[model samples]
Target: MEIPTELSSYIRVLKLASTPSWEEFSQVAKIAGAGILLVGMIGFLIFAIMSFIPGA
Candidate 1:
């Protein structure tokens, strides 16, 4: 008996999703936090610069 191609692919996806590794999750979380911090710093700088400008 042979398995169909579609069935094999589905099984492969299920096997991959069955495990949730903590190391990978933490790496993703750290990158996301750094990105948020960078965006916040940029916004603060823009606000400070605008405050010093003359009236429009």
Candidate 2:
């Protein structure tokens, strides 16, 4: 008897879902909100400079 080449044994991975603990949730959310605010401020500063261009 001969075994097929594709029949080799392999480890299988399992997928699982999880809910974040309270500390994990709050830390992640606050960091994300802070990032958005920081980006917005930087964008506003860049736009503010457009009004002062010498050619404009």
Candidate 3:
């Protein structure tokens, strides 16, 4: 049995997408975590400020 060229190319892409090195994954995860934390902190600050302003 033989795979066609197009099918082989698709399989190669799938394989690459499914596997990533640990360092690459960790770096992405760290960036995502920092972004989430920053957003959360900003939201908390806004809420705190609104509470103090009394009319907002």
Best by TM-score: 3
**RMSD per model, one decimal:** 5.4, 6.9, 5.3
Tens digit per residue, CA lDDT, model 3, 1-56: 45698899998999888666999999999999999999999999999999999789
Q: List clashing residue pairs in candidate 2.
A: none
* Tens digits of lDDT, candidate 2, 1-56: 34553343321222244688999999999999999999999999888898777775
The Cα RMSD in angstroms, rounded to one decimal, for candidate 3 relative to the true structure is: 5.3
The C-alpha stretches of model 2 lying farther than 4 A from their native spots are 1-15
Expressed as tens digits, the lDDT of each residue in 1-56 for candidate 1 is: 45698899989999888555899889999999999999999999999889988782
Candidate 1 accuracy as TM-score: 0.63
> Which residue pairs clash in candidate 1?
none
Error of 1 at 5 (Å): 17
Q: Give me the candidate number with maximum lDDT.
A: 3
